[model samples]
Target: MSAERTGVQTRITDVAALAGVSIGTASKALNGTGQLRDSTRQRVKDAAEKLGFVGDARARALSSGRTYTVGMITTDSFGRFTIPVLLGAEDALSAGQMAVLLCDTRDDHVREAHYLRSLAARGVDGVIVTGRSADARLPIDVSMPVVYAFTPSTDEADVSITLDDAAGSALVARHVRSLGRQRIAVVTGPERHRSAVRRADGASSVLGSHLVAPPLFGEWSERWGRQAVDVLARQAPDVDAIVCGSDQIARGVCDRLRESGRSVPGDVAVTGFDDWDVMALASRPPLTTVDLRLEELGRVAGQALLALIDGGMAASASVAPTLVIRESTVGA
Candidate 1:
């Protein structure tokens, strides 16, 4: 080797020599890819670790033309409905042996555009758009494989896995109906939200022939919850069951119903979505809700992106959502 080549400081070649493998093999194994045997991969990893060799991600990306880093663009920061999803996506990506770059736009179109473009510029292998209750109209066309989890973009060409609002809402209605509550009411978010509309449709379908006032529409906030309860009280005093779009709204409904001297399941039953009691799991009277399978959505999104990266075909897929019954909606 030339003097200049001999003076290179990379330990990858050293690690490869120790592992009895080619430098390219060491590179692939350490970078978490290639068709190497399991034992060879482990040996390469161990040797690299022992030699304190960190594979250069950029060089690997350049050689393979694959960045191996996935980006996630969230409309909101981690919240009641989104934390599980973020955690799940993180877990899934980590298991895939890929790095994550997170961007929070807080539902701003301009900021979202900036982040999306920035991620694209960085050469992310794929992107997962997470948890936006509003319509997502990204300004630029993304060149990377894109997956939408817990939220769908306005463009139908993008892949997505969202909570089955119809299924969740129907579950709540069925539970309330099982409790024999003849009068039902709904407190949901803005009418423009696709989720809110689907949940309402699901509830209406399941509560056939029952008396339900027009749904009280508002933001997904505890304040809206409190205000909506008051409005419902005046507008539909005879409501026997109330299904909230979210756990926060349900908490507001429960608090107001209690203050108004209504016994849960006796006078009015309440239910929520996103299994809101992740905070108060130890509480005696916890909330009832729907498990939107947020993390599972992450797993599916990651799998789809990986498949896309592998040049495998993928059809638009759906994940199942489940309901968790708790004291909030059950009888006395």
Candidate 2:
């Protein structure tokens, strides 16, 4: 049935009829909710635009009882890694006209609970939960939609975004192998950390027979890296290459190697991860490392969370590690 336009007023039912969809489906498309096909949504939008349909965008949003704000809750807001994710997320969210409310809970469950309740009371459209690592954790129950970034919720139903650490480590392994360096060893963080374990697993699978020995699971500090050097020396004095789990550990390994009169990428090659500029760029010969694309991770995570808030479907995604070559791996 053709929409009966009484004067210049075009009702929502008119747009619905023009789009050949039910009024509810048209409302979902207009309200930016429901899992409507992209084509269907576009059709509704086109019909609305064609008919010069007029409605208060903000009023329609408010009708759904939404505040048009997203809450980003992080355990470590100032952490080297967390900052990039936040920066990226904020950039994307700002572009989409979504205001972000940041809260640093620092892993304190009580503080976290308070933030959640406060954000819910503020009527935030959704929440993006970011943590220091990608390890799976218990699900958080809340009234609003949530997207996990950096840290993933173990619940299969929850959407998450994280770095592909194993794949990245494999890239590092391949780069070392390409340099004709065998006898590779890894010095990483605590064994219980899922990120460390995944990185080791990836490097080992690719290194195969080239691996000199198993990885040394220690702390994520230069001190541990330096201590690990002695252990590696005892285990394999002729170690030709070392793959550190982080730039800090790599720095310790490189410093110790220099003291031992080992030329980086000459007598012993080294590599690190996270592509931290301060550490990687200042090394005697810059450190080769993996760029986790954390900023991109945040942008993508923000986009995903926006989708969830819009009542659209978003799946768990991962960002790949990019190898950044420097003097540590390839001689200057």
Candidate 3:
């Protein structure tokens, strides 16, 4: 055996040399392809292991003509809602033997465009764009199959899967109404968000002639919830119930209501969207919230990506949101 030299970099050649075989034989043996003696394969594997040799993913993709990476782009606000969606998408991707490349656009077209270009350059097999809502224009030049989860692309060309907020919000409204509260108030994210608007619309359709607190336009933040309720308390003094766009927002609303000397469901009932488990565990009285089925959103998107990769036909998909009742709003 030749002695190792100082400052000499190692390569496949070095593995082949140490294994006493050709570079092609070393590659075949390590990759477990082509016919080779079992002992010979073991020798190549041990040599490569000792050398800490690993193949380049990009190189492998180029050679096979299938980049195993899929692009996932989302908005900054999506963090609260997209956790399960991403989890489901990753699960589906892993099961299908693919990798995910995540990017946050923060609801900016310029940033979204940059990521789209980068993902295309990387030759990703497909792209999944999770929107904060279904009211933004996607740059239409992306070459790979694109799937929109929870947020549909402005162009109808892209496949979309979203929570049926219309149904979910209406259900929440009915629950609030059945409690015999005629005066209702709502604090939601932004009117520009199609999901938020849809939720408001659904709630309105159910709670006719009820005073809806002026729709608060803000990001999905606890502080927004606090501020929204503070304003609502003064504007709609007779308000009997408060509905929040998300659970985090509900926490703020509940806290603000308490600070204002109002007892939850005793003075003013509070309800929220997004059945955030962590919030439910930490809140004083477990929050009554709606489950948007985020993981299912991810699962559907993942399945869609696989279908696209496998040359399957195009089809639209959607999932319904469900309400989870708790102490904050009713049955206290």
Candidate 4:
């Protein structure tokens, strides 16, 4: 009602009225919350933009007593996969005009509980929980909003955004198949590893008709890769493609195949997972891999948590893997 509450030329009501939505809807749209349809959200945003309306984050937080800070917990701490996810979450939160507080639990439940309590006491508006892999972990039984990044919660209802390992593996399988290779086989991590099983399931679903041998389960090391290569040669001597569950395994396969008087892509086409550049590029002819899009995963998690904090519906999402082609599969 007062001019002070309304800006000199524009007001929240003006935005809402122009967008054909309620004031509450306008507030949620500007605040980056309230699960409006993309079209609706865009309309609201366009209305605000045309009116030159700017909503101050600090002012909204002060008026609503909202902290505008999101808390993130990671089990793997700064492990290779976790950092990129964390970075993505940070970028997304910052863009939403929020801050993030990170707690590294190192896979300890006690420490995780302590951090959850501490974050709640600090009044974090929401929480993002991530892990090194996509395996489902137990939920953080906090009262506030929570989003799992790159890790699903055992509670099926909880919002989780994860990399589609099955999709990634199938992508590699199809790529190798497209290269005119019929006898495809797999070498991957331990059988107990969920990532390994999921990846195997994915590849097998697509390559069932073309598989020469079953996936060889082993550790996530070059030594295992080397050993598996030898084993597969005997089991399926005519195997023309080896689809590794990881870059490490693929690198090892590449090494052993060459040592055994086989040429990569000439005799066998090798591919791996996780598009981790260090290993992919350093290999003899570089590696063809599936990029899990870890950064994008984290970014989506961050945005989802923020939206839930703003009283929106839970956002559960899955990202498809991107196939990165290189000398190993394409042939230089």
lDDT of 3: 0.81
Residue 83 deviation, candidate 4, in Å? Answer: 1.1
lDDT for residue 239 in candidate 2, whole number 0-100 = 90
Candidate 1 per-residue lDDT, tens place, 35-117, comes to 98999999988887666665677787898798889988877776655677777777877777679998888877889889988
Model 2 spans > 4 angstroms off: 1-64
lDDT, candidate 2, 1-332, per-residue tens: 35436324887898999999999999899878999999999999999888878555467657867777899999885598899999999998888778899899988999999999999888889898998877887777898889888899999889889899999999999999999997999888999999999988989999998888888999888898789889998999999999999898999889888887888989999999889999888877789999999999999999998888777999999999899999998898
Query: What are the runs in model 1 whose C-alpha is more than 4 Å off?
Result: 1-54, 78-80, 106-110, 134-136, 227-236, 278-285
CA lDDT, candidate 1, residue 67: 81
- Stretches of candidate 4 off by over 4 Å are 1-62
**How are the candidates ranked when ordered by TM-score, highest leading?**
4, 2, 1, 3
Superior candidate under TM-score, 1 versus 2: 2
> What does the lDDT come to for candidate 4?
0.89
Q: Model 4: number of clashes? A: 0
Local distance difference test, per candidate?
0.77, 0.89, 0.81, 0.89
In candidate 4, what are the lDDT values of residues 1-332, reduced to their tens digit? 56544455688899999999999999888878868888888999999887778777568778778878888899997899999999999999999878888799999989998999999888889899998877788888999999998889988899999888999999999999888899999888988878899999999999997988778899998888899988987799999999999998899999999999999989999998988888899987799999989999888888888788778886688889899999899899
* Positional deviation of residue 265's Cα in model 4 after best superposition, in angstroms: 1.2
Considering summed lDDT, which 10 consecutive residues are worst modelled in model 2?
1-10
TM-score of each: 0.79, 0.82, 0.72, 0.82
After superposing candidate 3 on the true structure, give the runs of residues whose Cα lies further than 4 Å from its correct spot: 1-64, 75-78, 104-118, 211-236, 277-280
